[model samples]
Target: MTVGPKARRSGLPARDRRVTTRRVREDQRERSVRADVPTGGGDVGVATDAEAARVQEREALRLAHRVVDLAEDRKASDIVLLAVAGMTTLTDYFVICSGGSERQLGAIAEGISEGLKQDGYLPIGREGSPDAHWLLLDFGAVIVHVMAWPERDYYGLEKLWSEAPLLLRIQ
Candidate 1:
């Protein structure tokens, strides 16, 4: 005599026959792994976009200080950091400073450029010269402008980039 399917299964008892919730979850997890489901950053466990941004910003702040230190070392007359609303694509912060004369301005600009380089940031562009009244350094996330006192007064960049956040002001 052959035992029926239900009768044979019932011999094991209902409690033993049921699958545990933990086992079901494990099966689903295994299936997900086999399917190559997205876990955001894959196996290496890298930072997400927001975390990366925070790190970038922190680095930028460090660079900014380095630039300031270089300027101070080179004897720049005044240093200002502006968070202009819309001036350039790179930095949320703008560093503007002045020197006693055209020659001083050029030296200050050069020093800031070098300092930024030490921090692993390079200026995309620069303008003006020692003979001219002003010099500009355009790092991707921070822009530094060095100008002679007279030129700074005449151009009034602070007024031009009026919408900026105004992080620092020094005369």
Candidate 2:
């Protein structure tokens, strides 16, 4: 049994209800639906869903760092991360790091290659060799390049793709 305003009109309560109805109507009239609707959470600038995604990418980079640390820890030298923006913007980031010797470079490349594979990342392709002074591991979202120090300098990947976003740098 709903109480109609006519049935219970003491005066104050009915007026209050009318005021609330009017305010709601006014709000609806003023509000416009946005084209870019937010998904899953708050606004991106305000520590919401987008920020959380960036944090996740950072964590992924940290996992990549384990590969870097493994290289450094194994006596390899000079870790470099490069971001390569894809031709169609499909691939957003890249990582290029290097080691000391050809053997160590191979080890570093193998570590990154295996590590990324175990983490469920399939490389598009990989090239070069530890003995060849450079090794490339191509994960779709990011690429890992392991090179000897001199070869890294000679190619200068850092300068080549300098405009891409640098997500992490482990010296």
List TM-score per model, in order.
0.66, 0.55
* Candidate 1 ranges beyond 4 A from true positions: 1-44, 85-88
Using TM-score, give the best candidate's number: 1
Reference-based lDDT, each prediction: 0.67, 0.59
Lowest lDDT 10-mer window, candidate 2? 28-37
lDDT of 2 by residue, 1-171 (tens): 112556255445665666665565444322222223344655433344555556545654665565566556555555655444433243435556767677777777776667667865555557877788877765544556777788888988778777766656767
Q: In model 2, what is the error at residue 63, expressed in angstroms?
A: 6.2
Candidate 1 residue lDDT tens string, 48-90:
5665555556656666667777888898867887765266655
lDDT of 2: 0.59
